[model samples]
Target: MDLELRHLKIIRAIAEAGSLTKAASVLGLAQPALSAQLKRVERMLGGRLFERGRHGVRPTPLGELVLHRTRVVLPAVTELQEEAVRFAHAFAGAPRFRLGGTHGPLLGGLVDRLATAHPGVPVTTYTSWSEREVAQGVGEGRLDFALIGTCGESPPPATDRLTWREVGTDPVFVMLAHDHPLAARRQISLADLAHASWTDVPGDGCFADCFAAACARAGFTPASVYETDTASCVHLVQVGRAVGLCRATFPPTPGLVTRPLAGAPLSWRHLIGWHPGAPSAGLATTVLGHAREAHAEAVARNTDYAAWLVGHPGFGPAHPAAV
Candidate 1:
């Protein structure tokens, strides 16, 4: 019989199991049948693939060569099947929009716009503190799109076989208690806050290091920095225990205020990503448009950020977009 994918699987199973009996058990075939099948494969290939040995079966030189090829072929075929499934889902009546995001306001805004634009399509979101995780979800077909950010011209997460687009950009802002002394200032100087402790949402990025470098440039080592969840970061800032680092579009909190840092010492760039081969890729442009619109709405609603943007020419999407 010609060596087909099934034949390759059988060879791999036997090699992995180390014996015909174990291989049969794993492959759900009777031992005798498996042995017979193996004989045919060996006969077709013109050599003994496995040698009968005291301990178990070992691959012959021929077996080793075939096994090497099997390893390469199996994964490629598996990937082909998986990509086909993703394509099918995209073309099927309606594929749910599976969005992966690092915690932020842009994700919610995009979801809202997508739901309104594609009325009947179901929408869901997966949140992670790591941009890599969000990007990975898209690359792995678990998510249709990824919403993530990079710090001030830093590259986006490293994910293979995916396209990343800049949704927008904003200067990172500082969050402080409403009554904090710096809260009254329109913009705070990084050097001036040398004595203050800080808090920020935890993430897998170089932002923490970048913040440190920014502080170093400002001529003082920063005080204690607490990495925590968003809620904890807010509470820390609320109680005046620490100041929080936030995106420019961070919504107003009753007891907290967000202000930009002078010189735009730290900044963030919003990014949207997706696997180009995914079935859902067809909607990427549309979704990107919505993301841009969401970002614009965010820009409009945050009056302080809007005023800040007026003077900071380079901190927004690379191009104009509307939805």
Candidate 2:
């Protein structure tokens, strides 16, 4: 009758799904079996964890407490599993160096630099939709290093096992059609776009949230008409349907024009993270130095951002030091 990892998992599943049937489906268990397990778990804990309702189930106060603890425990377990795999690979005499991040021009630049610096060290790369995922990969040891974006916020909870170095800051820009009236302006403000439709990636994370908050500060809620990737967003803009957010590091897309936001209402920090035990401090330093260089090149190529950087001296390194 003692609790185990499986019990914790079941608790988390039920709390997340908010219904026994849905939780059973997610866990690949029959409804009856899952219900029986839940009953056993409740008995062991000496309390009811959920209250069944017409809509679904709601966690009781005790259930919330258990779920909170399980959230912490589960990620630690995953990190341990990843570390075991890494150790096994090391013992097998062919340890792999892996890196992960969201897809961007800087990623290609960083990869090329790593290749030239390490010469023969084979590297594995993974891409995710969000910086959070890449940071998690580094923290869990699945990746030896990761480059991720943050809205000047603190790192996530799982990052306790990782060390981070800021690579650069990218000022956010608004991307519009070449002929759009706003495109004629050298710089635009969020308030000017209050009536414009926006196309953004579908996510409740920092990327979307930061833009939304900026819009709120500009005295209007954004009218998001489409949720899609950057290329699709550009297409939407090309058709005169919506405006999209862009980073200074983004390459120019055909039929699109980018302008820096006046006062830089939205910007994010680029960071490189790795486990404390990862390779060598020198390697991490080299990666960060290359990243800064890549960022400088990106800014130089972006005319609007380059102009903005001239007036804003402390945003990023004026001249990135040689790696």
Candidate 3:
């Protein structure tokens, strides 16, 4: 059988996954079909590429050689495909820029800025709760740029094909009913909410995990009630059914109140990521700047958070004077 780019992709997927079953799942192929294809590939190469074990598959010497070549070839092929698409869109006069990220209030402001700056270019935005997914989309050329949030001090994950810049860091806040006793406080300690039942937006595992870690550091385990939509979660918070975690820049909710977490054990870094070769890199930077402005605006609109920001100048927008 003749080898092709698809074969190389399959080889890479199997090598990375370390198991045909897992690779098949990633490739959207049945295990039996992937096994047959692997057999054919091995027959063409005239040797066994991987050693099959009960645990999983391990690359043999031959497999390692093939994977080394596949790694180089796959990236080149992807670059070629991306370049071709770019050229095709340009030629067709359908210049488009695709943006993706987890949902946040800043996204709207970024879009507005882009629209104002590049009125001639059509733009599209996609939202996913998973920042990793959005980052992957940018790396794979499926998106021109993405706005992702990373919690804690660790830098956001890096990709060879993408460039990432920190736009701003947003302090984490606790959301509770406006009438709740603790809501009157200027700031709330994680310890104060130790016994409070918490609800998180479903499918955002990173945020949920970060919240849990902060709770752990506060010397308690948070009682998780249920995962639900943001609107429902806000409703729950409004009625004192539960407390929720929110960013300082989150828009105000009528019946709910937000207070910064004392000491800021939990915070997130907002990052703007884009393909290194994308023509829209300059535009992406502009978007990042606008996002910072949007975040500052959010701070101004939320008096509680604005006051918190005043006390903790180290966090929030880099240039407060501009805001």
Candidate 4:
């Protein structure tokens, strides 16, 4: 007595094919069976649905109207089913968390710590080259959290939707090849190397801004700089052509040593952020705590390196900690 999807489908096919026999064939049914189904639908709707001719068939005014309505209704019903399926599948699958960051050194050991602390919670990591992307990713649900450098103003994840905690702060140190003359000095200043050739990473990147800011603070603008985004900037320095600054969180390759500036206060602050809507699972909390500890450890180690530079045989004196 009630209309159903199969009845609506039959009507639509008949309207398109223009013949009962052809419409039945399209529906994978015999002509008689489809005709009976259509008649039942028409009776339920209180109207005749089609007109038969010697040659074929055509829809009546009532049939055309019903078919038009069904065309819109059926696809919406299908979409609802698919959307329900997508929800069930995504939520019912295994738990997965994604985190992104712009700082490589700070992220270096996090995976191991997370795996050890939350062995069951799968954490995926993504690297973003800029703070804008990191913040956007968290706000848009693409990432569960992000770690990045912050200057005077807070970095992106908008404060209304996201919150952050400072992990650690450390001075950005100029890394030079061991054989470079400044590399042998106890402490180097921006003035000491202002006129020297330098290797700079792309300015659009967060590190580049931090580096440029440090140079400006050091009373000089970086000039005659070779721009590179790869870690090879350190190797370029090793070859004795140019010097570059690397944060403590970056990998410590064989050929480079990081030294404090003679009397400069330039530092990069590391922060971790998460969305307000994101779940605070126990594992996430634990992983965040580990990241904070790891950051502190890196800062402490770099401080010891600075202390050694101050008293070392070749370098004359150590400068105050770059705050």
RMSD of each: 8.5, 4.4, 3.1, 15.9
lDDT of every model, 2 decimals: 0.88, 0.77, 0.79, 0.68
Cα lDDT tens digits, model 3, 5-109, are 888888889988989999999999999999999999999998999999998999999999999999888888877887776555445655576889786777877
Better of 1 and 2 by lDDT: 1
Q: Which stretches of candidate 2 lie over 4 Å from their true place?
A: 1-4, 12-33, 41-76, 92-96, 154-157, 202-204, 280-282, 317-323
Provide the global lDDT of candidate 3 against the true structure.
0.79
Residue 247 deviation, candidate 1, in Å? 0.8
Off by over 4 Å in 4: 1-92, 152-157, 203-219, 249-251, 280-284, 300-303, 306-323
**Which has the higher TM-score value, candidate number 3 or candidate number 4?**
3
Cα-lDDT of candidate 4: 0.68
Model 4: per-residue Cα lDDT at residue 277? 50
In candidate 2 the C-alpha lDDT for residue 17 amounts to 92
In TM-score terms, which candidate is top?
3
Candidate 2 residue lDDT tens string, 1-323: 78999999999998889899999999999999999999999999989999999999998998888888899999888868877765654465543457787766677777887778777888779987777777777765567788777764545334567788777877778889999988999899999999989986553246677777888888999876577876788789999999887777777778989988888887767777777664433367767887777777777777777777778875754244422
Winner on TM-score between 2 and 3 is 3
Q: Best by lDDT, which number?
A: 1
TM-score against native, each model: 0.75, 0.80, 0.86, 0.61
Q: What is the lDDT of candidate 2?
A: 0.77
The deviation in Å at residue 261 for candidate 3 is: 1.1
Taking all chains together, the TM-score of candidate 4 against the true structure is 0.61
* TM match of model 3 to true structure: 0.86
For model 4, residues 1-323, the per-residue Cα lDDT tens digits are: 77888888888888889899898888899988887888778889999888999978887898889988999998888656644543443465676667788745667667667777667978788886677788777665667678777643335446665677666655556778888787778668888887777885552345556566767877788777787765668768888888886664444568877777665345566777776555533245655677776665555556545454344333211122211
Q: Model 3, stretches more than 4 Å misplaced?
A: 25-30, 90-97, 116-123, 140-142, 202-205, 320-323
